[model samples]
Target chain A: MESSSNRLFSARDLIGFAVLIAIIFVVLPIALDGFRLNLFGKYLTYAFVAVGLVLCWGMGGILSLGQGVFFGLGGYCMAMFLKLEASTPENTSIQSTPGIPDFMDWNQLTALPAWWEPFNSLFITLIAVILVPVVFAFIIGVAMFRRRVGGVYFAIITQAFAAILTILIIGQQGFTGGVNGITDLRTLKGWDIRSEEAKEILYFVNGGLLIVCLVIAQYVRKSKLGRLLIAMRDQEDRVRFSGYDVASFKIFIFCLGAAFAAVGGAMFTLQVGFMSPTLVGIVPSIEMVIFCAVGGRLSILGAVYGALLVNWAKTSLSESFPELWLLGLGGLFIAVVMVFPNGLAGVYAEHVEPRLMALLGKSKAAAPDSAANETPAE
Target chain B: MFSDYTMNELGAIFAMQGFAGLILFSVFVLMALGLAIIFGQMGVINMAHGEFMILGAYVTYLTSNLFADYLPSVFGLYFFVAMILAFIASGALGLFVEWVMIRHLYKRPLDTLLATWGLSLILQQVYRSVFGAREVGVSIPDWMMGSLPMTDMIEVPINGIFVMVLATGISLAVYFMMYRSSWGLQVRAISQNRMMADAVGINTAWTDRLTFGIGCGVAGVAGSAFTMIGSTGPTAGQLYIVDTFLVVVFGGAASLLGTIASAFSISQAQSIMEFFLSGSMAKVLTLLTVVGILMIRPQGLFTLKLRK
Candidate 1:
C-alpha cells in the first residue's frame, strides 16, 4: 500500500500539485477581481482539453487535431439543458412555441425535436456531456487505430471531422441556433447564473473540476498502463509483437481525452453563458493542441499553466494589436516545434528545478534525476 | 424537387451544374497537384501551401494593376506575364521555406505541419497588412469575359473555360515533370530510398529545394487561375486548405492519377448536391462521405505499395 501511494505521488509530484492547487484555488482568486477571475476560469476550461491532449498526444503519440468537436459536443449538451430549462412555458411565453428554445421557435420548430428530448433532464444532459464525445471518440478511434492509421494521417482526418462538424452546425442553424449558436441561457436549476456571486462560485467550481481532472490524468500517467503507452509511442510494432492489444489502449486514451474536453466544454457554457459553432471548428481545435504543446505535452500540471499563459497572452495581445497577435502566435507555434519541443516543463526540469533542489540543500539526488530523465531525449 | 422541372429544363440544369462542378474540379486538380508533389514525394505536410497559392494571387493582382495603369495597350497580355511572375514569386518563397524551415523537420512530419501552420498565420498577417484585410479582385482581360454558348439553354462562362484550360495544361506539365524528366527520376529515387540515393551521387538537398519550388510554382498558377472564378482574400487560402488536403489524401497521397480522379469525384458530388440542398449542407455531406470512405480505406483510393 505504501509503495502504491508513493508510485502515485512522489515528493516532487506532491509539491507540484500543492503549488497548482494554491495558484488555482487561492492565489488567482485573491489577486484578481471578479471579472478577471471569471476570465481565468474560462481559460481553465481549455486546460481540461490540454490535459487530455497530454495523455493522448504527448504520451500516446495520437495527435488529434479535432478536440474542439468533443469540447463543442460537451458545451452543446450543457447548452441544450440550459436552453430547455430557460424555455419553461412561463419564461418563453413571448415565443409562439412557449416551451421550446427561442431559436427553435424562430426556426419554426413547433415542438422540441425527439433527439433533444433526453437533454430536458439535467441528469441525462450531464451524462451526455461526457458520453457523447466519448462515443464519438470511440468510433473514430476504432475506425482509425484498429486499421493502424496514425501520425499525420490521423491528424488530418481529425481536422476533417472538425470541418465537417462546423459545417453541419452552421448549416443546421434553425436546429442548432444557426451561426448565432444557442444563447440566452438564464439559470441552472433556478439559480441566477448571471449574478456576480454566481460567477465567482462557477469560477471555483471550474477550478475544482480542473484539479480533479489533473489528478485523474496524473493517476493515469503513474500507472503501468502509462509505461505501456510510452513504449507503444516509441515502438508500436515491438509492443504489438509483445502481445499487447495496442489499438485498445489507444482507443481508451482517446476516449478519456474526449471526456476531459467535454467536461471543459460544459463548464465553458455554464460560465460563458453560450455555446457556438465557432468553438467546434478546425482553428479552435488546433489552437487547443497548441495549448497542450505550449504546456509541455508530457506534463499534466504544465498543461494548465500553458493554457493560462497562452490564453492570457492572446486576450491581452489581440486586444491591443490584433494583427501582431497572429504574427506572434505564428511565431510561437514555430518556436515551440523547433526550439523547445518539450515546452515549459522541459525548461523547468532542465534549468529551474535543479537550482531549487541545490538551494534547498536536499541531497536526495534520485528525485531530480528522475524528473530530468522523464523529459524525452529527442 | 425533381417534379418541378421539365425534362429539357432538367437537362439544362444538369449541364449547368456539371459545368460548375467541372470548374471546381479544375481548381481542386490545380491545388491538389502541387500538394501531391510536396506531400506525396517529399513526405512533408506543408500547411502553408494555401498561403503560397495566395501569394501567387497577390502577384497577379499587382500585375493587373501595373498593366492597367502604365501600359493599357498591352493589358490583355498581362495575365500571362502575371502567371509567370506569380510562379517565380511563390516558388522562390517555397525554396526559401524549404531551406530555412522544412529541411530541419524532414524527420518529423507532424512538426512540419505545425511549423507550416505558423508560416501560414504569418503569411496571412503579412497579406492582411500589405493588401489590406478586404478581399481583392483581379480585372479580367476583355477576351476572357462573357460566356461561351453551348446548346440553346446551356452557356458556360468564358473565364471558367480559361481556368479549365489552364488547369489541364498545368496538370500535363506536372505529369511530365514528375514522370518523364531526370529531375523527376532523382526525386523518386530519393523518396524511395534517401540514403541510397545520396550514396549514388544525387544532390538530394538541392533536388528537394527545387522540387518544393516547382510544387509551389504550380500552386501559384492555380492562384492565378483562381482569380478568374473568385476574389482573393487574406484568409481565402484557409477556406481551401482543408478541402485541398482532403483531395490529396482521398486520391492517395502519392499518385497524381489518384488525385485527379478523387478531385473529379468530390467536385462533381458537391456541385450536384449543391443544386438539391443548401450549399453548406451539400459541403457537409460531401466531406462526411469522403471522411467515411477514408475511414474504410485508410490508404485511400490508390496507393503505391512500398515495402517497410
Candidate 2:
C-alpha cells in the first residue's frame, strides 16, 4: 500500500508539484501585472502542448513535429465560434453579407458554409476543438503506426501534414479566414475577452485547467500503461511479442497529445484573441517539440517550465535583439540535444533533487526509481 | 477548364505546361539527389539541406558578380566555375557539420534531425546577415538570355534548358558514382553492414564524411542550377525543403532510380495542377496525394530488397 501510494506521488514528486503549482497559481500572478500575466497565460497554453509531448515523445518515444496542427485546429474552432458571435447581422451590417464572417464576405461568400454552422454553439465548438485534432491524429497515428512506420519517418510525415494543413488553410481563405486566420475575436459569449478583468479570469481558468492536466499526466505516469510506454520505447519487438497491441497504444497517446494541444489552442485563442496560420505551420510545430526537449521530455512539470522559459526568452530576445534571437534559439536546440539531452528535469534529477534529498536528511534509497538514474542515454 | 480553350490552343497549353513541368522536374531531381544520397546512404536527415543549396546559390551569385566585374570576357563561362565552387563550399561545410555535430549523434537519428535544423537556422541567420535579408538574383550572361522559338505559341527559355541539361548530367554522374565507383562500393557496404565493412578494413568514419560531403556537394550544384530559375534568399531554401523531402521519401530511400521517378511524377503533377488550380491549392493537393500514398505504401514507390 505504501509502495503504491509512493509510486503515485513520492515525497519528491509532491514537492515538485507543489512548487510548480505555487509558481503558476501564486508566484506568477503576484510578480507580474495583468498584461504580463496575460502574456504568461499565452505561454502556458503552449505548456499544454509541451505536456502532451512529454507523454507522446518523452514516454512513448513518438516525436510528433506537427502538434501545431492540433493547436491550430483547436484555436480555429474557438476562433470560428467567437467570430460567428461577433459577426451577428447587426455587427456586420456594413458588409455585403451581413451574417457571415468578414473574410467570407470579402471573399464574396454569400452565406456561412455548412461546416461553419456547427461552430455557432459554444458547447459544440468546444467539443469540436478537441475532437477535430484527435480525429486527425487518430487517422495519422493509425495510418503510420499500423504500417510500423516510426522514428524519423513518422516525424517527417507529421511535418508534411503540418505543411498540408497550412497550405489548405491559406488556400481555402474564404472558409478558413485565409492566411490571416480567424482574427478580431472580440468576445466569448458576449463577455468582452479583450478587457483586463476577463483576461485575468481566463488566465486563472487556463492555470486551473493546466493543473488538472498535470495531475492526469502524473496519474498516467505512475500507471502500468506508463511502464508499458517506456518499455515499448526501448524495445518495440519485445513488447509486441509480449502480446501488447503497440499500434493502439501509440494511437491512444497521439490522440491524447492532440487533444491537449487542442485545449491549448482554444485557450490561446481566448487569450491572444486570434488564430493564425503562423501558429499552425512547420516552424512553430517544430519549435513546440523543442519546448518538450528543453523541458526534459520525461517530466510533465519540466515541460511547463520549459515552455515558459523558452517563450519568455523568445519574446524578450526578439523584442530587444531580433538578429541574435534566431542564433540563440538555434544554439539552444543544439545544446539541448547535444549537452543536456535530459533537459531541466534531467538536470534537476541529477543535480537538484539529490541535493534537496540530502539537505532534507532523506536517504537516497527512499527514491530508487527516480527518473535521473533510469534515463537511458540516447 | 478545358471548355475555355480550343483544341489547338489546348494542345499548345499542354505542350507549354509539359515543358514547365520538365523544368520543375529538373529542380526536384537535383534537390532530391543530394537528399537521397545523404538520407538513403547514411540514414541521416539533414534538415539543413535546403540551406546548403542556398549556400550554393549565394556562391553562384558572388561568382557571377566576380566574372562580370573582373573577367568580362569570360562572363558566359562563370556558371561552370560557379557550380564547381558551390560544390566545394557546401561540401566543405557539410564535412565540418558532420564532424562537429552529426558524428556524435549518429546513434540518434532524430537528434540528428534537431541538430541539423539548428544548423539550418544558424546558416539562415548567417546568410541574412551577410546578404542583407533580401532576395539576390544572379545576372544571366548574354548567351543564356534568349528563348528558343519552339513554336508560334510555345517558347523554351535557354536557362530552363540549361538547368535540365545540368540536372541530367548530374543525375547520370551520381548514378555512375553510386553504382560503379569504389567509394560508392564502400558506402553501400557500410550502409548495409557497418560492422562488417569496418572489419573488412574500410575507414568507415572517413567514408561517412566523404559520403556526406559528396551529398552536400550535389546540393550545392543543384543550388547553382536554381539561381537560373529563381532568386536566392535566406528563407527560400525552407520552402523547398518539405517538397524535396517528400520527393525523396516518395521515392524509396536508398534508390536513386526511385528518387528520380518520384521527383518527376510529383513535379509533373504539381506543375500541371498549378495551371488549372490556384498555386497553393495545387501544392496542397500534390502534397496530400503524396502523403496519402505514403500512408498506404510506407516503403515508398520503391524499396531495397535487403535481407535483414
lDDT of all predictions, in order shown? 0.92, 0.92
- Expressed as tens digits, the lDDT of each residue in B92-175 for candidate 1 is 999999989999988888888989999999999999999999999999999999998998899999999999999999999999
Instruction: Please provide, for model 2 over B35-153, each residue's C-alpha lDDT reduced to its tens digit, 9 standing for 90 to 100.
Output: 99999989999999999999999999999999999999989899999999999999999999999989898988888899899889999999999998999999998888889998899
Judged by lDDT against the true structure, how good is candidate 1?
0.92
TM-score of each: 0.98, 0.98
How do the candidates score on chain B by TM-score?
0.98, 0.99
How well does model 2 score by local distance difference test? 0.92
Measured against the native two-chain assembly using Cα atoms, what DockQ does each of the candidate structures obtain, in the order listed? 0.76, 0.78
- Candidate 1 residue-wise lDDT, A50-99, digit = tens: 99999998889889999999999999999999999998999889999899
Model 1 lDDT, residue B105, Cα? 89
